[model samples]
Structure formats: C-alpha cells, structure tokens
Target: MSVTRTNPALTLGKYVALLAYLLFALFPLYWLVKIAITPDRLIFTEGTDLWPSTTTLDNFRTVIFQTDFMAFFGNSLYVSLGTAAVTTILAAGAGYAFSRFDFGGKKIIVAVMLITQMFPLLMIIAPIYKIVASLGMLNSLTSLIVVYTAFNIPFATFLMQSFFDAIPKDLEEAAMMDGCTRFQALRKVILPLTLPGLGATLGFVFTAAWSELLFALMLISDNESMTFPVGLLTFVSRFSVDWGQMMAAGSLALIPSCLFFIFIQRYLVQGLTSGAVKG
Candidate 1:
C-alpha cells in the first residue's frame, strides 16, 4: 500500500504564513534599532526610512557616562536574577508536590493560586505598599526581589508542574529500584530532562522582573535604587523630554535580556517531552 505525502502547496502556504509572522514580530525590534542608530538631527527628518541617513554612537556614550544608566542596569540585573532564583526554587518544590501528591485542600489551594492571578495587580498595590512599608522594605532592592518573586511564583509553579507531569513516573521508580533515594532520582533522572522547562521558566521570570516598572516606581524612593525601566522615566524633563537618551537607555536595556535568552536558547530547544508518552 502507498501512503500519500502532504501537498506541496499546503507546505508552501505554511512556510509563507510563518515568514509573515516572523516579519510581524520582528518589525518592532527593527524599528528600535533603527531609531537608536539614527542621528538626533535625522530622527524626525528621516520619517519611516528603513535605514538611517546618519548614524552615531554618541547617544550610547552619553547614556553610559552622563547618566546613572549602568547603576540602573546593575540594579535590574540583581532584582531579576534574585527573583528568578527564589521563584524557581519555590516553584520547583511546589510543582513537585502538586504533581506527586494528593492531599486535603489541594483543590482549594490550586483554586486560590488561580484566583490570585485573576485579580488586577493595581487593585492590590495599595495593600502591598502598606505591607512593605510596615516591614520597612521600601526603596530597597530586597523589596523588589521579594515582590517580583511573590508575583511570579504562582505562574512559575504551574509551568514547573506541567513539566513535571510530562516526565515519566517510571523513571523515578526504576531509579529507586536501583538503590537511589527519591531526591537522588529526581536529581539524576529527572532534572537533566527538565532543563528546557527550567530554562524557559527562568527566562520568563527574568524578563518579567527586568522590565517591571510600576512596582519599582512605587516601592523605590531613592534615585540610586531605581531599576532600568523606572530609570528610563528620569530622562523625561519638565519641558523637554530627552528622547535621544531615553531611547538609548531603552536600547541598551534590551542587551542583557537578549544575551540571557541567547545563552539558554540552545538548552530550551531540546524536546523534554520526547519520552513523556507511550507510543
């Protein structure tokens, strides 16, 4: 018996659709780079030009030397990394429990977590501010890290639980039969397989914390403690906004996130679900 292959026209159409989506998603990034490179004098004059008539590194130089750009970048990095680490650890534990155990109020706990995500963050900002103030954590990087971790944990836990659920319970059972403890089985047999999910969770949480501005703005009072997103607002003057510097800082802020994803994109591509299902 002969089997028919997919129609070439259908394959071609799918490729065209994918290419269109790629262009749509990438156009904004292209605009950012275009604007960042265009000279201040040519910014408005070159309206809609694909290429800049003139390019200069002066904006980047001024952002680096004349402003607190580096400090803000460092602060953002600290908070993002801290939040990712803490949230990942907590989520991993919670996800494992959710995946492996059945206990009283499990449904209620999951429902509550889902409910927490349903509320608009703005609604809780007042209560959060009061709590942070009572704890004397305002204007501190620790406060930012804590808040970001708290907000990110529920989603990250769900992410981790999905990954854990995709893993085979048979592997752990076999490992235990081979004289390994549950923790050892998880470490050796499961963790290596879950690298893609971990990388994705880390990337998501890091980006979320890195670009967060509202909470950072409300919780921080000191200029020195401002994150890069909040610090971008500093470029705005009462009369004239520093468009050049703000865009420069904004462009610079993209570097770390880009670099982070680049570093993890390899591990993130592996199909952790390959052995998850029986044929």
Candidate 2:
C-alpha cells in the first residue's frame, strides 16, 4: 500500500484562508450581538470598540416585554413552519411523480414552473395581492402560508427531484419484487434516503417564509398579524431609529434559523457527500 502525503505549507495556507473567510462571514453576527448588549447611549460612542465599556440586558428585556416582539415572533414562526411543512410535502410527492412517471404535458409543466421563477416578484406582487384580496385572505396568516407554499413548491419539487434522481430506481424495484407495494417500497427504501433532500427543502422554505417581507407587508395590514420582518420597522421613526432595540430584536430573530440549521446540518452534510460519491 502506498501512503498519501499532503504539503504542510499548503495545508497551513488553506487553514489560514479558511480562518480568514470564517472571520469575515461571522463578523456581522458578532457585531449584531455586540450591539444588542451595548447600552443605547454607548452604541454610537463605542461603535468601533471591539468590546463595550458596559453592557446591559435592558434592550432584550424591553423588546421581550414592553413591545409586540413575542407576537411578531410567534406569527413569523407559525407562518414559516406551516409554509415549510406544506411546501415540502407537496414538493416531495410532485418530485417523486416527476422522477418516476412519464405523463402528458410533463415538459410543458416543468417549463411553466421555471417560467414562474424567472419573473421578478415585484411584477407579480400586485396580481398576487389582488387574488388574495378577492379570496378574502388579506391580513391572514393562513393566506401567507398558502402563498409561501405555492411560491416554494416549484423549486422545491425540482430540488427533491434531483435527490430522487440520485437514488437508483432498482432499489425500489427490488423491494417491489420482494412483495412490497410501491408505496411500501418508497417508505421503506426510498424515503429514508431522501431525508437529506427533505431537510434541505425544509430549510429553504423556512428561510424564505421567515425573511419574506413584501408579501406580508402587502397582505397584512393589522399590527397583530405582522410578521417579525415587518414588525422590525416599528423600531424606526421619522426622526430617529432605535438601534439598540432593533439590533436586539434582530439578534433574537436569528435563533430559530440557527437552531433549525443545527438540527438539519447533519442531513445537509450527508447531501453533500451523497453528491460527491458514486457507485
């Protein structure tokens, strides 16, 4: 057997480059947390300081208690989770069908889906708003969920289709030959392998719904129904902005996304490796 060797100098350089990239990427997050804890008065004064002379939990406290923060947070969470689940389920079924079946209008349907994605959201916002208004869905969380699910399904279907493509049809066929139904074979053999794809689709849909402001702003006029992104605007006034409280709220908003990624990170890694390796 031959031993594999790596250049120490090259390895060190790569590590240094990776470290630099990480720092560059994470600096904004670090600054967000820093500003969240920094006292309001000291924010501008100590903005450039690596460490604040003083820090306080007052911003977090006020945000959590005195404002509509929790309500907005809850609204955002509900919409995002609802959208993710609905979109993923529909996308998975559609993807599997697309992958396994040859049906009439298959190419045309895919082309339409692609076309839908090509238009800027601005162009369709008015039409979407009109449709929602006609349906009496304006200012409704359920409406937001429905709209998000619709918008996400096409791309998510394509994503899941790619994952299904990576998996061999022979696996399901063999299971069917073993006296299992097609659904059974899918559940027992194929679904488990598609976990990475499902996780990725969920992450994508969740992030999309969570950060969506335009549709929410257009459809939701009520203060109570406003999602977190729109609610963040409350911290801004005509004359001045509440930097500390805004930053605090922004920092808090990142928790769900981070926890979600942490939960699915393993699946994401598996997806990367699954693409890299071949039989």
Candidate 3:
C-alpha cells in the first residue's frame, strides 16, 4: 500500500473559510445583542460601533417588567407548544401511514398536499380570515394554534414521511414475526429509531409557529391574545422606535428556540450503530 500525505495549507484554508462563514452568519445576532445592551442615549450616536461606550441592563429590565411583554410571551408559548405538539403527533401518524401502507389515493393525497404548499398564504388568507371570523374565533390564541397546526401539517407530514422512509421496513417485519401486533411493533421497534425525525419535525414546527407574524397579526386583535412577534411591534410608534427595548425583546425571544433545540439536539443526531443489524 502507498501512503499519502495530507495538505496542511488546504486544511488551513478550509478552516479559515468555515470560520469566516460562521462570523458572517452570526454577525447579525451579535449586533442584535450589542444594540440590546447599549444605553438608549448612545443608540443613534454609536450605532455602528462594534462595542458600546456604555451598556445597561435597563433595556432588559424594562422589557420584562414595564410592559405587557410577559402576557405576550405566555400567549406565544402556549400557541407554539400547542401547535408543535399537535402537528408533530398528527404528522407522525400520517407519515407512518404514508410510508408503510399502500392505500387508495395515496398518490393523489400527496399531490394535493404538495399543491396546497404551492399557493402563497396571502392568496388564501382572506378565505381563512372569513372562516375564522364566521366562527367568531378572531383574537384567540386557540384559533392561532388551530390555524398554525392546519397550515403546518402538510409540510410536517412530508418531512416526517421522509424520515420514516429512511428507516427499514424489515425492522418492523422482524418484530412482527416475534408475535408483536402491528401497533406494538411500531411502538416498540420503529418509534425509537425515528427519534431523530420526530425531534427534527418538532423543532421545525415550533420554530415556524413561534416566528409566524402575518397570521398572528391578522387573527389576533386583542392585546391579551397577541403572540410575541405581534407584540414586538408595540416598540414602534407613529414617529419613533424604541431600539434598545426592541432589541432586548428580540434577544430575549431567541431563548425558547435555543432552549428547545438544546433539549432535542441529542435526538437530532443520526447514525447510532447497532451490531445486530447489517445493511
């Protein structure tokens, strides 16, 4: 066998490129936090400065205590978690069915879902608004949750189906051969393997619902029911904006998404090997 040498220069170049890319991507988030901590008086004066001459926690303090921020936060939390949980469960079931079952109209059903995604939300928002209004569900968190779940399910189902497709059907077959019912085999043998898929779907749906502004803005008129994205607009007024407080709130808004990813990150890892199975 011939030995080969590694290219140190190429390796260094790759690392340098990756570092540059990461800095470029994360710079905006850094700026958000930077503005958040900077005192209000210096916001316009030192806007371009990488670091503020002076910083304060007053922005954070005000966002947390001086406004209806907590109510908005709680409303968003409830809607997002409710949407994510409902969407994930429904998607999981539908995905498994699509993956394993050969049913009539499977192709047609999939095509319909794909078609639904093709139309922009703006195109159908009016009809949706009319329906929700007729039901007297306007300005309600539950309505937001329901609408979010409905809109998210098709894409979420497709995402989950791709994950299910990645898993081998033989695992379930083997479990069934040992006398487990289909549902039992699915629960005991298949679900554990699909943890990565489940985690990813949950994360995706949660992020989507959490950041959604248009629907929340349209459906929720009541301040008590507003989600965080809508609530953030309270910082803006007829003539001015509260930059420090707005940035502080934006920075704080990132916490739940970060914590959620942290919680599911382990399940997001793929390629855990088992000696019992050979591919």
Candidate 1 lDDT, 14-123, residue by residue in tens: 99999999999999887877776777888777847898877888878888998888998899999999999899888888888888889999998888877777789878
What is the TM-score of candidate 3?
0.86
| lDDT for each residue of candidate 2 in 88-198, tens digit (9 for 90 to 100) | 999999999989999999999988887777788778889999999999888999999998898888878887887899899999999999999999998999999998788
Q: What are the clashing pairs of model 2?
A: none
CA-RMSD of model 2: 3.7
- TM values, all candidates: 0.84, 0.86, 0.86
TM-score of 1: 0.84
Writing each residue's lDDT as its tens digit, candidate 3 over 63-94 gives: 89998888899999999999999999999999
lDDT (CA) per prediction: 0.82, 0.87, 0.85
List runs of model 2 lying over 4 Å from the truth: 1-16, 237-239, 265-279
Candidate 3 lDDT trough over 10 residues, lowest sum: 270-279
Residue-level lDDT for 87 in candidate 2: 97
RMSD to the hidden true structure, all candidates = 4.5, 3.7, 5.0
